[model samples]
Target chain A: MKQDQDEFYVGYQPKAPAGIAGAVRGTVVLLLLLGAVAAFLIVREQKDIAAALFEFGVVREFEGVIAAKPYPMLRVARPDAAGDAEAFSRYLLVAPFKFGADPIVAPFDGKKVSLKGTLIYRDNKTMIELAAEDALREIGGGVGDKPVSFGEVTLKGEIVDSKCFLGVMNPGELKTHKACAVRCISGGIPPVLVVRDGEGTVKTFLLVDRNQGQVNQAVLPMVAEPVAVTGELVRLDDWWMLKADPESYKLL
Target chain B: MSLAYQAVGWNRQKKVYDGWLAVGILLYLAVFMVLGAVLFPSITAETLLIRGFGTASFVLLHVILYIGPAARLFPRLLPLLYNRRHMGVSMFVLGLAHGVLALIQYHVGGDQFPLVSLLTSNGDYASVVNFPFQLLGFLALGILFLMAATSHDFWLANLTAPVWKALHMLVYVAYALLVAHVALGYLQNHAAPVTTALLGLGVLGLFGLHAAAALREGATDKEAEADNGWVYVARVDEILENRARMICAAGERIAVFKYEGKVSAVSNVCQHQNGPLGEGKIVDGCITCPWHGYQYRPKDGASPPPFTEKIPTFRAKVTEGKIYVDPKPLPPGTEVEPALIQGEGVA
Candidate 1:
């Protein structure tokens, strides 16, 4: 067992120049430690800019009937004595839109329902994002039967998700957050279009199919990207709805 | 080569190599961050770090892959090969930073665990255009982690050289995955033609270098053989005393040594780590492996005694002032008499 190990050092016993491996390892360890410290120091807890932006939008609840077509919309009865269907102010109910019909809103169509969620207000625009479909509860009988008004318009903007844009991810929309935006939309987060006017003021819209159903897969590739979309614009509460034919939206 | 491990055997050259390597990596990262800030002022700091370090590490990985074939093409490049493990570990660090920053910026907001959200958030795997590109990057990073964590001689000794070398080969797999990660993720949104072109050119360059090196080696292995199954290698005067002249006969690399006026031949592949035995010389009358200082008897291809390592031997003869090696090789450790030349006194 104690045989000469030198026998294994056959022919040429090349002793290294003597300082290479150690210096290399020491340098490597030092660099790694420095990098870790720098990374830790540079990256701190980020401020919740999204929350501050959300504070600009006021929150409220509505008792209405759900528009369970291409996407979910709520037709709220006017608090005043206007009894006809025209007396209703329709508001689109936005939630994290997943694949297929939503389990909560799909069953409560044409029935009086109560929507309890945060209603965001910006530039005289109102939009509410539901934490879950359970926010839509049947309230015994149906409410608004008025014809849902629609107007055709062309809009330019970037498609983003309400969850991240409102408060979760700071400065969330752009080329960098594109993949995250795509994931949020695909995972059933309702997509919102942040359109900027000539005055640099911003307005947001919920993007859906022409019939206002889930457009998660249809616009999945276009998330967080700027584009021009021609769609039927509808007014629901303070929320602006863009029911575009999925094929009509073009990347800019 | 020592009987006991002492953590590491240090040398001045190794220290110098590591110092320069560290300086190069830090300088690269610093330049990247500075340039990013100046060029894209509106981008957030986190985004800059993620993209800057991500691209830097990707480029470094390509350079690491290019070093091997480059060294074969030019012996002067061997110094780069000596410190490559340091380069790899540095790359892993840069890559880990990019991955961590990306996770914090994108996936940490939701109620779901960030990793879980990354995997399940996008189920559009069926569409090529919408494939989960992040998954490719995630898997590649995992491979880099494995290679980095085990990148020491201690691991090499425990796992054995062949297995350790094989495990490190997964870098190629990681490279392929990273290519897809960039193509499908950033390029899709940014539409930068120049970046795409550069990626294509880097891949082509690596391919060209490897193919050229392989072709050269193949030519050496195809030299014509003599009628008696002996292949002509070199003239007796061409082999330096105490050194060797390497030859390829019947596809086997043989190192023929000339020492004390006698010639002996053994397989060039060292049993320790497949090091180039031909590059080593006869020291104290024993053949030594230059890589880790392993030694053996030139006559029988065997370790002196109590050591079990052995290599195959070949019959070498000198006729007409030239050295010739038999195409057939003998079993490992088989003893053979040394061949004597005319000018040299009978051995």
Candidate 2:
């Protein structure tokens, strides 16, 4: 059926036009202009902005206990907004840190520690400060009583109030039950263990979110074990969260 | 006789060439629009135009490549298959678009100097994998541009047909390079399976169709027959007016046709695929193949429009109530005056 249609017309070779070269040259010039504009727009969209962090500037050798459960949050604030108000306060519903201990006999609420981290100001009321894992160096203890500002320090502490919370457990059930038993122990919540740095002189954290299911799988078996975590120390309004990679801790 | 030859020279009044040029242009524009939507959205208008034009050129080459087979397979497709030189020129322009835009994107953007970057960026010249595929595309495009620039009849007449044909064959080389350019450079980075699959399917499909035609022709070659001055056969009545018939002649099938009150004899097979012209019909004063729609002027057996294939024609004459064919064939691309065959049995 298709071949029958091909028989109708005599094929002729068209003569090439004289001015075709000039027309093509003109078109190419136009095309170059189009490409340049498109490339510029794409590059612009991917650019990053820079801001200042003055108030939470440069704290030397600071340490503290895990005073509160550090829920990851994002705070966007204008530097010159009136009355130290935060422009954007959105909780990072999914915590990015993984935990490594069980709940039954691990550290409870008031763990102590001495650690170093950068203090980033996310506005006056809300500021998240943490010593990133890469910056965790073993600086020697302070000399004399001259109020040493060594810019960096390592935290020494005992495991305190640590229990795995809503993030680690299954979606609906936060209650102490057998269903949550996989993350928790026989009689306690999943370990959100907090270590006290030498008799509660400084407090720090050990909290894990649900997405770190692999770490939870590894840590749930070892309940009541004393461990030391090395990570970036972050401080946020009277609280500090250790942004530690799961590999940075050793169970003693 | 010279006046007659001049009168029979190419009929310029026919708008077949103009129609083909328009179709090619429209197809080029359509391809540009499609590539623009796919590759240039959210980009600056300048980049869009450059990339669009580049893609358009690639499509023009593709169109030129396919037109021959398309005309062979569908005679109605003949009108759309004219204007080879314009099509070539259009393809060259499009090639320029692709080459220049790519150069700006990968070379001249910032701190990198263009020439140094193309030559020395990825070690030595042997590693085409590491070598800038864009540069290869650039070179191929340059060749195409040069060819298009010289596609005039003046140049064609000056240069022998063989040299002209050899230069035109660079299109295939350019196409190969462009394919590599897309596969290695764009597909490697984008990693989109669908786009890769689509491109792969198109190239494979085109090649496969041509291959199928070639294979079919080869299979039928053994049964063809021939004789002196003409191939005397029982199926002479099968030749339709303005149409052709294939007669088996000494292990070769010869195309026999009648047009303008004249009988002409040429090889039965299409140059592209050895398609049986006997099964095809008369279309716009040409004998068209039924299998692929390749058309030939019955007077001279010259391929028309997009077809570049030429077959040896056997000088034919009707003598003493018998159709006789010459055992010797005129060289390919030969133009001969046709002789009329008489009798109601000669369909």
Candidate 3:
């Protein structure tokens, strides 16, 4: 085919490289199977029980006093509680009624109310979603706001989403989960401070603003890593709430 | 060779190119995933995949971009330029996987659509700290999809060479978008100075190589002098042994070689991907293409036996220690005796 022809070449053409048909075929099949397995596992793994909780159709009754800070929450006092320092008066109840008027406010504040809802509890964080507007019924007794004391403390921990850290994502707090954690926090998920005391007992605190509003954008950088937070700690309704400025957290 | 298509045209070179490409991708993924798992034990699988594929694609894009200018400076690097489009497509796949996984992980399960959420979630565009970086990534991915879908000879044929070349050049835009994406997206959260510094260094290196090559070519273009029907390329002593000096004349680039006490000239453009043959050396008595090792005889511009590739040859003479080559090119593979140096001893 050797010819002394004067053909004007116009452009560059790619040459076909060596073949790997069998290897390529095998790789495609393997990747397909792997993708299937990965999807199944990712979908199957329980990140949150929000959908399952709604699916249960279970009606729960809670007769408790409501605390109207951060959000309107119920403090269901445990009756057979001993005088132990670790045992708090009541556990705070979270309600999933965002972007609307709170069921318990002003007139219903500090009042004994019996609420009916589907209860979702994971780790130490508990939230309830009402099925109907009339689910929260005011029972007649009224009590004044409990006197709260805020003590300054320094704690080491990672800031994480209350939902995912409680049950949704297993081992969710790390450097690798930084971006996702930031997203979750930015998407209005309440940030929780997960810490270990000197005894190595893991404790969680709902991080709030100075006036106890839900902490969002400010705490994004502190999520998913070990950091030392200096803040005012208030033990209210069986939960420790941390109120601190974003600048107070030091990365460790 | 028609405009009608086959999914892939498998040849010895293409098969090898694709095989190595597949193997490279697999190895990269395996290493990335394994290292991620070991280094970050507390991270979820979703996070690992996002970081893994994201870094892999970013690194691969840089490698793909470097091949062009690197080949220009050194001919031996031409092999990397061959079938580089495959590398490009592979990068897009990895990038797509990363983008999709990240979207699902961070944006899905919300009230809004995932893609919509990605675009709208971070609305603090005015704030540098909270800039909408996901938009950059999405735009980049869009450009990549366009390039990948049209990276075929069929498109080239229909679109015409100049149009196709110009359209494919959007890769630079995609590259710029990806740089901004990483700078704003990943680095914003994970502030590792080493990683950031490395990325900066890579960008600088790319610009540095291109600028250096362009400056060299600019000097060559300015130095070339033409007379009547021939152009002064270089002095006989200017071209190193077995090497060639390239010159542009009469709307064609030519490579004038000095070998074995004789001088010869041929088209500078390689038959395989138009690699600069002047950058290559005469290996085993043939002008070996630096890009993919395609060889041709210096005297006839023809490939050796069992190969039929050819390129145009030109008349070159060394008169008074200065080499001058005719602007007119001879028919490809036409044997022409090399012009001998006057009074010079044979090597």
Chain A TM-score for each of the predictions: 0.60, 0.28, 0.62
- Best-to-worst ranking by DockQ: 1, 3, 2
Alpha carbon lDDT at B10, candidate 3:
59
lDDT of 3 at A71: 51
Where does model 3 exceed 4 Å of error? A1-161, A164-188, A191-234, A241-252, B1-4, B215-219, B234-245, B249-252, B255-347
Can you list each candidate's DockQ? 0.09, 0.03, 0.09
Q: Tell me the whole-model lDDT of each prediction, alpha carbons only.
A: 0.69, 0.46, 0.67
Residues forming the 10-long window of minimal summed lDDT in candidate 2 chain A:
A169-178
Interface RMSD of 2: 19.6
* Structural similarity to truth (TM-score) of each candidate: 0.67, 0.48, 0.61
* Model 3, span B2-49: residue lDDT tens: 224787765666666678678666766676566555544444576568
Better of 1 and 2 by TM-score: 1
Q: Which predicted model would earn the best TM-score? A: 1
Model 1 TM-score is 0.67
